[model samples]
Target: MKRGGAQHEESIIGASLVAATLGLSVPAMALEVTPYGAIRVATWWTSSTYYNPAGDPLHDADFTLDLQGDSYVGMRVKEGDFSALAELGAYNPKNRSAGVELRMLFGEWNFGNGKLRVGYAPSPYVYRSEMIYDADGGFNGYASLFDGRYAQIKLSMNNGFYLALMRQENVGLAGIGATNSPTTNAGNGYINTPFNMTSTTYMAGYTDFDTFMPKTVLGYEGKAGIVTYGGGVAGNYYKIRTVAGNVQTGKDEIYSYLGFAHAKIDLAPFEIKVAGHTAQNLGNLMNNAAAAAGSFYSNNPATGKNAYTYGGWGQLGYTLNNKVKMFTGVAYESNEMRGRTSDDRMAAFANLQYAVTKNFNIVPEFAFLNEMRSAAGTKQERIYATGIKWEMKF
Candidate 1:
């Protein structure tokens, strides 16, 4: 069982540079580059090497972990009907200085008060929720799902339906593993952006391999009876290559997933939501790396591999006399793997964020895999990892 150990760990040497830029607080209402990121020093101790479902090991070293989290600084400038901006990351080494990892350039100026955003970034169809059952695919991997690192565009309308288009990393999008959506349509288009901006969106104009691919999604959320629901159908084509750049041959694959999920919680103490989805192979458009070659896989249909997922999440948060607020949250996920051998896994995520002070905070989380049980012979096992993460605005 090969394991992952922070190979893609982001750097955090420019905490000051990012902070200084945000402190500037420009007066432009058009758009502003906000400095954001988290510097986390953490350590974990896991007994099993092949335990973590997300590929990254839980922590075996006793050293303080230096992590430069999603911290980025960029500005959104506008020029009349057109808009654009420059972006960069605090980490430069072991990275691409060309807006790759750092979204160093982006802009938007549509016809509406909210025009379409276009720039170097990932497109839609790369939709990914917080957790894929309990894996890093949800953690930091979602950003990589659609390779939101290149030319992309988005259009926001008045009805809450948004259209997005994106060009992927490495220049094309075919035979790649595109992410799914959390909402059924409108409500869960991409992240929580009012404009439906998120890493999971894929509104590219094409869907071929080689240079680029077209990723598309339609999302919406509306009140249904007493419950609110949302989700979308997203698809993409990607090219598959090996460490040596060998492109996938034979029956290539194009994948797409559509889900409808909803949740309503106006009450306190405990709120709940449930959603389900239906995914389609959509036949072989370009390439399908998910399947080995001649293999096809599907869930039970109603709520298994083939479909089912929800958004918003379930919560049980309690404020302990204002001093401490303890909370437990859970989310549901579905898998669309192409084989029974590769268990279509669903995961549950639960965590607690503690406010120690106004400027500082601590968070501890536990992630579990519903079907990622241990293997035989080897020491495969169900593992648990907990760590203390601190956050500061300045």
Candidate 2:
């Protein structure tokens, strides 16, 4: 009886060991990985009076053939509740082969009817136009407000509502204008507001300024029948300190905010979209040519007030056949500052995309940009560009 009881005990122990070994050997959820990329090249001719100021000589029209900066390669990995994406942009319009750029690198997790995304990725607040004229989408400057990709921590619901905390820029310099590199004549139409102090990029010093918090972005989007719509608002705050010989004399708190909305309707062969925004001190938060044209105002240092900007763009697209499609759009933006000069600009574009195959597309597009208004004593320029872009997706 004792021997039988011992055998029974040994059998129970063996069973437990086998069960533990099987649990250890079984692999966790298998990760599914996918790779994707696209290659794009554009050869086009462009003519513009943008670079020629009043006293500058007339420049000849220029032609260029280069890789579109938007081309990218990326990998997506998913493991049960977790997913990640790493993408690298292929080219830089400014320098074709400078190096690959980190377009997006982020990890996301699905939890409790929501998603948590962390790292550098496209801003949740971004809405782009279908104007495929330049290497990047053409109307990004004049109409659409693209905050670009930056570091952020975002939480989004399955219901299309999201919030994010993004990196902040300390735009506290006095007499600030032209927030970004002026690639087009958009910047040429502006004269820096007259102030006793010149523009400086010294916002990082302890005596210069203080960024109180990250930029906050909140947005929501959803589809209702054949119509889709979305909108969001963003804002940031910073304080600028006056330091004379390393002694803090005074400080000023600055606040910037913006609100944007977009709507689209799809009916068979016809598609329509419209988007717009209104903002104060837009350049302090993001970089866009139109935003730079209407950035913060410090013309009167003693009575400084932020600049304001408003603009909208609309597109009408039609499908001609299985292989061809046509799209036309118009965009306009205006910048105003009380007690100072204001600026306005308008743009229009038309394009036809022909699909040679499911993966190949040829788009011939034409675009026009006009500076509708400029400061006193400044000459505005008109720009015209026609180009063909070849894109292949894999």
- TM-score computed on alpha carbons, candidate 1: 0.56
If scored against the real structure, what TM-score would every candidate get? Answer: 0.56, 0.80
lDDT of 1 by residue, 1-394 (tens): 1123222322322553554455465455443344444434333333333544455544333223433334455555455677666655443222423222455456766676556776665433343333322222332211112233545667766566666664422111223232222122232244454342223333332122232455555666556565655556655554432111234222233354444344454334434444344444321221222211211222223322221222223444455544455544443323233232322333455555566776576666655533342111122334445555555544
lDDT score, candidate 1 = 0.40
What's model 2's overall lDDT?
0.73
Clashing pairs in 2: none
Model 1, which residues run further than 4 Å from truth?
A: 1-37, 49-64, 74-100, 103-105, 120-150, 168-213, 221-229, 238-255, 260-264, 269-277, 281-325, 330-339, 369-381
Q: Which candidate is the best by TM-score?
A: 2
Clashes of each: 62, 0
